[model samples]
Target: MTQKKDTILSREIGKLGGFGARLVAGLLPKNIFELTIETHSPPETALEKAFTILSTEGKVIEDRRIDPNKPAVCAIVGSGLGNLNPALVEVYVVSTKENITKLVIIGTAKEGLIKQYAGEKAARRIADLLTQVLP
Candidate 1:
């Protein structure tokens, strides 16, 4: 079977403000990350599903919200344990083909997070977790 392109790495996600900003922030690389899902699914509804997925790991630091310009767009913010700052990284979710979900996580580190987490293999890890988290 052909390997699927992680939606978080897709061009469609770059179109999002959060994703676009993260990309420019150098927190993630273009090829390293893409939208694992892209569809008409709104961010609010999508976030409900995403939070369910995130809950599988543990409680998130904050609630979800939609991008003002992209209401359908939603993001989850929380911090990783043991990091210098307790602030959570941002993870964005969007809808895609076949009802699958797309996942994009912004590292809170801002400087080394991408280098540490945005690698090819890291993307796969994030994708797999996202797949389990979303419907």
Candidate 2:
């Protein structure tokens, strides 16, 4: 994922790697969070657990599964905002031939300053719930 050079996040990521002079016309700022969880489970099992947790939460909105092969789901939740908030949390359970499975969770805030914070918080909640529920 790429960040806008003018934004604070882009400047920070830029320090790690120099920015490529790209136009900002179609660029959108996204606050992303990632986690890799080690589990001895299948993608379906992990996806089920995450779906249950998010669906049970009242804050969750637009909760839907993106894919089952990779077993990914996304939801927009009330991380201090209503349905209109762009704060999105996406969880993916990826598995290889081995028994190990990697659960990746990402939070995206497409707009607003406070929404960015909300996106982070929403991501944390999803990760925490998955950790507590999944084996």
Candidate 3:
């Protein structure tokens, strides 16, 4: 599987955040959060487990291997619509060693300047869910 192209909103947000972060430094707070965990399972198995875990939480929007030759690296993106401000969760799986896999789960949400906790809340929710089930 190949990485899916970013949605228009996502692309624009990336541009805005990238530029804003650099231009204003701390003005636009970070909207992305990442959590990493190591699993004893192989990459493929780990990815499957992660998919199942995420599916229960929300709709999985995209899933694909990063490279055909390196199937050990893959990603899954999901959307959680339970909140008024929806959040996107991206999970990346990489094989680091024999029988060892690393799972990087990132949660991103749009936030307002005055209220900047949405992103962190989304990230922490996904992190807790995955941590309780992944390992």
Candidate 4:
């Protein structure tokens, strides 16, 4: 996955989407990351690949489409120490340009006060791992 510090995306995410910045808002402590990958892959193909990659490193609890008509999937995976760290990942596939598909990934996880450091790190790790598998 390509890493970027996209100011435009940051702005749009804060002002747009039905989420209305709720997903991007900071409350207490939150670990969140987003990735946009362009490929010529199908939505289900990318979703399956992400699930397989995450499963190798963690236990995937949920893998389902957010809506029947939308090319989006939401999955939750747990890893590390009896699955103490769990990550919620949302992937949206969009057709960009002529034939390229752009996969938008949003991942989030909570930071527990008891093990504050571990929680955030593990959560981001899950996001990083999942990003590598996006088609």
RMSD each, Å: 11.4, 9.5, 6.6, 10.8
Q: Name the regions of candidate 2 deviating beyond 4 angstroms.
A: 1-28, 58-69, 80-86, 111-116
- In candidate 1, what are the lDDT values of residues 15-78, reduced to their tens digit? 3346655355444333233435433444565666655554553335455454553222122222
How well does candidate 1 match the true structure in TM-score terms?
A: 0.36
Those runs of model 4 whose alpha carbons end farther than 4 Å from true positions after fitting are 1-28, 59-62, 65-68, 79-83, 113-135
Q: Rank by lDDT, descending? A: 2, 3, 4, 1
Task: In model 1, state the lDDT of residue 90.
Answer: 41
Error of 4 at 119 (Å): 8.8
lDDT (Cα atoms) of all candidates against the true structure: 0.40, 0.58, 0.56, 0.52
Runs of candidate 3 exceeding 4 Å displacement? 1-30, 65-82, 114-116
lDDT of 2 by residue, 14-116 (tens): 3334564122311546656677676776677777787787776523433344553445666555463554333556677665457877878777654444544
* Pairs in steric clash, model 4: none
Model 1: residues with Cα > 4 Å off, grouped in runs:
1-36, 66-87, 93-103, 109-126, 132-135
Q: Give the TM-score of candidate 2.
A: 0.61
Per-prediction TM-score, please? 0.36, 0.61, 0.61, 0.50
* Residue 22, model 4: Cα distance from true site in angstroms: 21
Q: Clashes per prediction?
A: 17, 0, 0, 0
Clashing pairs in 2: none
- The digit string of per-residue lDDT tens for model 3 on 1-135 reads 243223422443445456553344323444667777887776776667667766776556666644444442222333334354445666677456876778777666555455655455665666676677655
Instruction: Evaluate residue 26 in candidate 1 and report its C-alpha lDDT on the 0 to 100 scale.
Output: 41
Worst 10 residues of 2 by lDDT: 1-10
